[model samples]
Target chain A: MAAVVEASRGERDNQDQELVQRALTRDPAAVAALVRRMAPVVHVRVARALSRRRVEARGRDLRADMEDMVQEVFAALFESDGRALRAWHPERGLSLENFVGLLAEREVVSILRSGRRNPWTEDPTLDTTLNELDTDQQSSAEGRVASRQRLDQLMDRLRERLSPLGLHYFRLLFVEERGVAEVAEETSSTTDALYAWRSRLGRLVKQLARELDDEEEVSDE
Target chain B: MSEDLPIRVAQRLREEDEALDPRLERLAMGALSPEALAELEADAARDPELARQVALFRPLSSELQDRLTEQMSAPVAKVIRPARWTRWGLPIVTLAAAALLLMTLRGPSALPSYAGRVEGGDVVLRGEPTPAAQGRRVMRGDSLLTLELSPATQVDGAVVARAYVRTPAGARAAPGVPEVDPSGAVRLRGVARELLGVASGTVSVALVVARPGALPEPDAAFAPSEGPRLEVQLLLR
Candidate 1:
């Protein structure tokens, strides 16, 4: 039974290699097959990323942007003499499919990361509102100053609450822009554990923000 | 050189894949030495289709991290603290605040509380299920409860880890979990009323996706960043 399974696995790997080789030659049929085969995988990754994005952004629609991300992944894989695809060395242990998948994952992560940074880019109306606010200098400047003060207060509170390790994690991740693996290694934790700790901290801070908002709302009322 | 990053990212991303299917935990954990990871990579290469599914989920993993940072570090975010009073005085003030909050939450609404029945066909939100509307009321009887997972993305190929409906009476596995297409629209036909014995009050619907595996318990509070689960509560009239 194990031998039968191994035989099938070898056969599948051979087929994958042929497809990728043909694809590298820019054979339209091979390229098309590659895309058709990979599209769902790409779409799913992009879709999942966007879905999480929609949630974090408070339920804004992100579907319209999905195609762009998927296309970017394909382009990266097939572009420049199929550099990305050619780089896949099955002999080294990863199959061609997984190699391409790596590309798709990277593309989706890049898109999600960028969207998180600006966010307004995902919705033009938000950008327009900010532009409008900028033109209204007197009120905007006053608002900015007030916002800065609030930020200072929030940071002070955060510093007080975070453990020394947590604070260092934050600084390394955000301020220094270190990767999760690097930070995890430095902290003597797995990436998953680091994620959980960070999430716990964020929830605490968000709760604090929520209470402040509630208090202000009551005062206004 | 740039290729190095994706490989590392892919190694890290197995964390999500493992969450969906514990069998992949070996890959998910960075426990593999470089040589071992390479062998695993070769194995993954043989199955591009599987690799793609696993890769697509990496974005969700990254998003979870992004969300944590976004929530806590946003400029002008505030943190509230109690006034500087005696410890006992603070507790008293906190108790007063808690009572006030409870009152506000349970306060009368424009819509009535769940009387234990939904009157109409299930209200479905396709492509993107929004958060449940609290004040919204539903009729109790003859209502078919349905949920649409939005941006159904990979649902067509996704293995349903577990799905069900729950209510005050009890919990039951849904007769049919969401059926999705390539367009990422999953339609779960409603048998929730029967399964949940949901004669009245509130019914909670939950859907969790994973690779094929043993059925897991339903998580009502599941969020995407928590892995692949969607949950919404409906208040019936």
Candidate 2:
């Protein structure tokens, strides 16, 4: 089993190297292959993050968003100067799983951070409105109730690790729903920094969302 | 050079991972160091998928860690208390709350209590909203029970969570998760996850409604999720 696993890793590395070359050559097939190879990893990570989302849906609508996040990452990664990925180093002990995991985390975090939220609350307005809707009703379905709870948990987790500055940044950028120019003016930071932090924090949130989801899953077990 | 931060983040992640539930333990790019974490993380690290996941998360300062502990609590967000109140809340309380987190109760679960039974079909939310009306009908498959909007309304996916006051006017829809404006009419926002899907099976949303009055009744102000909400209405149908 160990030998088989090792062989598979080796084989995969070879494939990746070839794919990188072809991608760099602007081969669309390589890009497609890269997505096919990596999409599931991102999906799994994203689903896990969204699971942390904690909102119960009659239908799993967020699944669509999760899939989009992963797909976007693959598209970006493969759209290089030559469609070849410059970031990967397969031989130095980088695993595709980790590579994709990192990407998903960053993506998920950015998605969460980008949403304009309620600054005083640190909760996104959209999400908050949804929760309020759930609570106001006279009777609710068990499933919907569960979804609401999960949403709450996911939000709590997002706010959990935020620093004062980070929180302030998030408030200005997301909660306060400020523009990049506005955020820069308020923080005395450049627009680039604000953009970069949003991305960074977004990645962090995505990671946390996945973790929160896993936490939910683990608890189920 | 930039990668070193991931290393520190990974170390902290490993620490966090040890305490995390299994599925969440190793999803980021940097996580439990195979060597540094508890036995569980060490074992999880051996898997390339998990290890790769550890690397994906963002790294922040320790200040965030301390803040996380505080942020996870609703009581903290709601108010600041003295040491005595804080002591009562307890870290253990929050830790224990992991089990209790994400308990969203939408619709009739909002009210304190009352009961009826449905003989056939199931309750469902159908139709659109009006100034006087919010959502309509309740269904479980072909069988349907129409629902008239009340106050304090909440919706989870399809399930409704709400509470009722004395008069029909007082009774409202479920509590919206994040809280909504009632100036016009009933509107909903998704919030807090209630039940979770176990990896093996589909986690479903089941709806219920209770029209309980009086705060002191046996059915009054329950967990908001304890009873079969649609049962009474179902019985009526």
Candidate 3:
């Protein structure tokens, strides 16, 4: 069954790559196909992200905002000689739809952040850590293999500290990279409750990090 | 100093991970067999990260799939209407009419010249033509516009084409995003109302084809330096 799934994915990847290649060359049919195929995925992702915001306060219909966002997402993909389209690496295990969906989420997050006066008040170090981790993943293969044991140990420690619900939140927000509203909906919780949980989790993770650092210091001494 | 530990842990986790498995995505969509799902869940039990992944995939995939199906099943007119003219209003009618008359008297040559290199290309105006054949081709208010790139000008890189309708009020981006047919011909349909707006007179439809970054800005002067461009004047009444 896994083999069948893998085979189907392979076939779909081939078709996606072909369509993307044609789109890169501005082939109208291929471009149209791509827009039609990815628009809904982008729209869903954007809408999910926007669900956290007060759309009513913004004085625009949610559908209208979603429509504009969808167009902007496509514009970004086709801009700069299709630079974003060319960045898709299916060999890395992400399908084109997922890739575009992820891009849409990031775009919406960026837009949301921009609307705020001080978006960085919630742990300015988090972005830096994410970027550093992303760089590590891209730049080192042997280092990654060597780090597997450490990663497993860390995960074990983190799991020990978290309750079952906290663990679920970790999985949804951090591991699966889902939007806050979607995670809240899945867990049958309100966004307010989820936000509280997220803040608590952040503090817990930081505390655990401090404990690990203390342990290392004691061992060194 | 303690803050550095989380970053270190994050780096290690990222390094240890490979890209997401496509099979997991299928499982999330409920396409996997019962046996396959059982096997996946068993594996997930040991791997907390994978377990978390499995937990979220089902809802995420289901939502996206449902939305995609809904959008695909929607009628074409309904889909196109909101997106094309969401920014336009009826207040521009008088200004657009005056602008059209001025452009009509100025002749087709009065349209901005393509200062950039012009490779051979053509903009074929589709729909029924009016009896007035003097200055520019007059078409009914509902004509579809077709843009065809000559075989010689089809280049190797990303060629992007954008259409703009120039009126006295200014240039409004034509509502219909161009779709290419199977034969490589680009078609912009259902844009007559958008291009004509509420005012009907002489409208200049400028089709700009260029490499992605070189495409002309909508409100700026229509001078591009990268690829072929075509302009056509239409009398819509």
Candidate number with greatest lDDT: 3
- Model 1 misplaced regions, further than 4 Å: A1-7, A58-60, A114-221, B1-237
Per-residue accuracy of model 2 over B103-129 as CA lDDT, tens digit each:
333222233222111122322333532
On residues A1-221, what C-alpha lDDT tens digit does candidate 1 reach at each position? 00001112334456567767765665443443455445545656555555433423433434335544655566566656566677665544344545565556555555544545333355544335446566776886857644533443344344445533454554455445578787777656789977776566556556555565687699899
Clashes of each: 20, 157, 0
Could you tell me how far off, in angstroms, the CA of residue B86 lies in candidate 1 after the best superposition?
Answer: 64
lDDT tens readout by residue for model 2, A10-45: 454665676556545444333333443344456555
In candidate 1 the C-alpha lDDT for residue A177 amounts to 58
DockQ of each: 0.02, 0.02, 0.05
Residues B1-237, candidate 3: write the lDDT tens digits.
Answer: 254444455554444343455445445333344566788889899997566556544423323222332332333322331232234334344534664686577632211112111111222334433222212555566443333332222223234567777777778777646543222233343435453352477766665554446656776424433344545566666
Cα lDDT, all candidates: 0.45, 0.39, 0.51
Q: Tell me the deviation in Å of residue B169 in model 1.
A: 47
- Put down candidate 1 lDDT per residue, B92-180, tens digits, no spaces: 45644775676577752221110011213334433433223222334453344544333312122334434566765566666554554
Error in Å for residue B66 of model 2? 45
Docking class of 2: incorrect
